[model samples]
Structure formats: structure tokens, C-alpha cells
Target: MTGFDSHLFEGRTVVVTGAGRGIGAAVAAAFLHCGASVIAHAGRDLSHAEGDLLSRVPSAARSRLVLLTEDLAAPDGGAQLADQVLARTGVIDVLVNNAGTMGGRIRAGEETAETYDHVLDLNIRSVVALTGCLLPALRASEQASIVNTVSISARAGGSAGSALYAGTKAFVSGWTKTLAKELAPDGIRVNAVSPGTIMTDFHRRYSTPEKLEATAAAIPLKRLGMADDCAPAYVFLAAGSLSGYVTGQVLEVNGGQLMP
Candidate 1:
């Protein structure tokens, strides 16, 4: 997919949250590759991400990249980022709401108020707050899109320890459809990409090697997915040329792990 023409996204401005690593990083890279000026946001700092990107991205792409490090969990985080982006660029062509988390496996009986709050805050609340902040910019674009990163867990109710996290993603999945209908009249497409058992730092913490092997064996593909594997779905959704008539849909990138 490299060597794309300069006109692909010549003047487009894309905002990708939680782009410091994993799928977020891959999404940012994909957008940059297609000639879009990308505003990549990280949660705390960009020290590690900066190094990672500098090592991979070409010099020309660096000029088009803007790395933002803001704590998305803060009450005013979304507004602050939105204001900054609007100040620099009048419009945001694409908004990828990919910042999320899966709190460790804890049963409903073992959960506490704080646990639920933390999980829900990052998974769903932040997406709503951030999108609200950028609605104006998104509405300003003649071709706008909001691609959310959901999970296959949402449909399955998740594995034993991930029920709460799955519930939050389920809310996002439902909201994506509702918002798509509401925003369709304005030409702003809303959709989601659901990834399954990707091999990333995320899984390193939540799933053991044995567990991953078992998961891979169970999948029809007999392999785990990479961050790159999931990035193209976001690009396809963001690119009006490809997914112009597509909206309110969930594109799953799980190698047939979950049919629904």
C-alpha cells in the first residue's frame, strides 16, 4: 500500500488518539503513508513512541506528523486536544477514536466501584467526550469519518475476566450505529473495526503464550493477527473513495474468530 500518490490525502488532517503503540500506532502510520497530515495522540508522553516512529518513518513523513501527549483520562483532555487541533487546522477530516483499555480479568463478584470506573472511563466515556469535543471540526469537513476501534469481545461477552471490558465495547459498538444515523444527514460517517486476539503489548499483559497458542489453534487461520493487519480497516473506513456509501458498520479483522 506504499507509494501512494500525493493526492490521496493531500490536504487532509487526521486525528488518531492513543497512537503511541499497538493498533493506534499502526493506524497513524497507515494514514501518514497515504500522504495525510496526522495528529497522533499518546496518553502520557511520547518519549518511547517518538523513538519508535523515528526509527521507522521516513524523513518526509516526519514533517507531516504531530505527536500529542495528553492524558485522555483527564476531565478536560478531549477539549484541550480539540482546541489545539482547531487552532492549527480549521478542520479534521478523520477522527479515529482508538484509545481504549481492557482492565485485567476480574469477575463481576470480585470487581469494585473503582475498577468499574477505571475500565468504563477509558473504554467508553473517553470516546464520547473526545468525539463531542471534535464534532464541530468533523462537521466542517465535506468528507468526514469517525472510525472507532472496538473488539470481538463485545459480541462474545468476552472471556472469563473480560466481561466488563466487553460490555463497554458493546456500548461503543451500539453507539457507533446510532451516531452514524444521526450524523449521516450531515455527511459524517461513523463506523467501527473490531479486532480479535492481535499480537501486541496489550496481549502480553492479558494473555499468556500458552493462552495465545490455544487461541491461534482454535481460530480458522491458525495464527494471531498483527497491528498492521487491523490498520487497513481503519484506512478503508476513513477513505471516502473506498467506503463512501458505507456507514454505521462494524468491520471485523479477527481472521474469522467470531462470525457475528
Candidate 2:
């Protein structure tokens, strides 16, 4: 919990999706701590924020926080969120596409068309739609940075029951690179943060304690990661002062789990 410069993001506007809890909440709070006005999409509800996210922000900074709730898996979810953002601000300094989920385990061969739609809708379609909808605002900034949330599972192929989720992340990893190149001319940098085995509710619902312990034992650092551990990377990637020249890269925050 080291402190960042209070004025690092002064006068900036940042939008973070999936900010109700876990990694998204930490990233949103980090921007608020650094003096940015933030628009946080709190998933489908505010239940997770009551205890987890709201407590993390200082009262003084609360004035700069705007919370929105939308189900990104719905047909027009991304567009709806973007409309809200546009109504609030004309320009965006940072966009963190962190709203995504595995939607539970659908084992191989047992995957239904319904499951496929849900996974893709939440993970891939929503991201594309949101980013596309916000491109003009992003371009309006003198310099804008997009930090997407990918997963180590994208590369490792993941363990049982998560192949579809892994594929979506892989798609995002590739899209991040492609968007970096496509948007470079507009002075917008696109990159991604690929977290490895974070100990969030994501794992609580999708993984067993035995499996998590085994993962920790196998990692070179002998532990899984925490949401705080991944937050600074987003801040670094989002701040032009910090990572102005960095783009199209997947920064790994895995506690040495994957060297690549």
C-alpha cells in the first residue's frame, strides 16, 4: 500500500469497468487516490461495493467517484455504459476494461450454445462494444491509455472446465496488441494486464481450496497474488508520466509464476 503522488493524475478522468469488487475495485480506488475523477462501473449491483470498494476510498476522494451498475453480458450493455460516460465527460484520459468473468465452469464437451454466448458476450463482445463506443472520447484526449484485463490462463490454457474462458482472454490479448497499433496514430496506447492466479472471489467461485493451495505451492514465489498486487500495474500503465512509451504489451503480475 505504498502511496502514489497525489497529483499524478490531477485533472484526469478515468473509467474502470467491473469496479464493484476485487481487482477492478482496487484499480478504481488507486486512480481516485492519485487525484483522478473516476467513473466506476460496479457490475450488476452495488452489493459488493457496500463493504469492499466504498471502504477503500478516503472520504475526501469520494466526491470524485461516480459509480454505475450495468450487466456487460447483456446485448447493449457496453453501449449503455458508454452513453452514461459520454453524458458525464467529453474526454477520457484512461479506460480500464476490467469487467469480465468466467461465468462458472462449463466442462469440455458439456459446453452448451447458451454457455458459449454468455462467456463470449461477457468477455469479448462487451469489451469490443465498450471500447468501440468510447473511441471518440478516447481520441479526444491529448494522450489516452487503455488497460485491459487478461489472464495467465490465456497462455497456460487453464485447468479443467475453463477452456472457453481462456480463449476469450487470448482474444483480448491479441485485440489489445492490434488496437495499440491501430490507435497509435491518435496518441492512444493500448495494453493489458495479465494476472496469474489472483486470490479474488473469482477463484472462490470457480476453484477449490485444494486447487488454489496447489497453485500457490507450484508458483516460484510460493504464493498466489492479491488484488492490491495488481492495482499498481494498472495505475502505472494508465499514467502517461509512468508508462508513456509502453504499449501493446501484456504486463504480467503473477508473482513469478510465468516468466513470459
Candidate 3:
């Protein structure tokens, strides 16, 4: 159940999406440490060896790492990503849809169809299609889990920076609950992780210096979040023995940033 609890992921096969950097990269490292073979999937940007994520990872577990690239936002990309993993691993025990976008915001009148669609395409549509495509492979495993990376934007309303991004994540907030119910009977667990304002590239891009400091200062914990802090939640959900009864839950990793 915990990455610290046990090597629960021993011999498992996992995929870490948007894994070239930031949170996704951190997640891949955690899983690799737990004895799982990792498929490091990324969009166009984070692709190869040099500054690529897999390279930064030390050689300790490098043999378990398989670095690959695919743009999940484009048509057929999700299926292609799954297909690539299937071709090599032949089966997958977990799928982590961690790839996303967070660079746009517009009020109702100012929003464009293309912009909205782009966000939805990568954040929501890709998740759905990839989940469908990977079902067969996931089912073949003795235990399977799916973790959708969501955001505080999924429900919080105060952010002027996440107008459209939040809307797309709201779909994630609702869909993961429903998907969990639908997939439970298949012996697979589906859940979402809604992280608060972390110091990821996404946050760095959207937050001004003043805004960043203010947001961190306002948190009850007096600090922003980190990728390492959030990655273990995914590990727990993916470990059946540890989180066999956990499903359809959104585990928030923010530091008292959004309270219900």
C-alpha cells in the first residue's frame, strides 16, 4: 500500500506518462525503486537521452527503464502509446496518465474552441481513450490500477490562471469516480490524485514571483508541494495488497491549500 510499506510493486510493469520531467519524472523514479519495470512515456518535448529524464536517473535501476516518446494530444497517440508498451512489455499492471497542459485562461466570452478542445483533448480525451485501449493488457495482470493526475483547479474557483485548465480537470474530478465504479468489477482500481499548487513547471509557468510567494505563504503548512511528496500516492493505489480496498478516491497532496 505504501512505497515505504513494502516493495509491493515487485515484478510489476508500469507506465508513467509525461515522464520526461517534473511530477511525472518523479513518479517514474519511485516506481522503478519499488522493483517495477517502467515505461517512460512523454509528449514531443521530453524525448531522448541527454537532458531526458531517464538519463538523469542513475544507473542503479537504469536497466528497468525504457524511454519512449509519443504525443498523446494528437489523434491516435494514446492508443499508440499503449501499443508501444504492449509491444515491448506484453502486459501492463498500471497506467498513470500524468501528461497535461496548463498555459491558458479565458472567460466565457474570450475562450476559443481550439484552446478549449486542446486542453480537453490532452487532459480528458486522452485519458479515456488510453484507458479503453489499455484495458485488455491491464486485465491480463493479476492486479491493475489506474491513476489520473488531476489538479486543485478541478474544483477551486479563485484562480484567474486556470479558467480553461480547471474546466478540463473538473471532467477528471467527476470521471475518475465514475470510472472507478465501472472498472471495479473487472478487478481494476481507478482513482485520481488532485495536487495543489506544486513547484512544477506548470506552476512556474503560470505563477508570477509575487503570486507564487503569496500562494505558498497563505497555505497553512507555509510551503508549496513537491513531486516527491505526491508520487507515493500513485504507488499506493497501484499496490493491490496495500490499497486493495481503495478506489474512486481523489487523494489531495496540497498543504492545506484547499479545504472542504
Q: Sorted by lDDT, highest first, which candidate order results? A: 2, 1, 3
Candidate 2, 43-84: lDDT as tens digits: 999999977788889999999999999889997899999998
Q: What lDDT, from 0 to 1, does candidate 2 have?
A: 0.93
Please list the C-alpha lDDT of all candidates, in the order they appear.
0.86, 0.93, 0.81
lDDT computed for candidate 1: 0.86
Q: Write the per-residue lDDT of candidate 3 for residues 153-180, one digit (tens) a residue.
A: 7877638746778877888879889989
CA lDDT of 73 in candidate 3? 75
Q: How much does candidate 3 score in TM-score?
A: 0.93
The numbered model that scores best in TM-score is 2
Which lDDT value does model 2 have at 145? 98
lDDT of 3: 0.81
Identify the superior model by lDDT, candidate 2 or candidate 3. 2
Instruction: Work out the TM-score per prediction.
Output: 0.95, 0.98, 0.93
Worst lDDT 10-window in candidate 3: 1-10
Off by over 4 Å in 1: 1-6
- Residue 73: error of model 1 in Å? 2.5
Compare candidates 2 and 3 on TM-score and give the better one: 2
Highest lDDT: which candidate?
A: 2
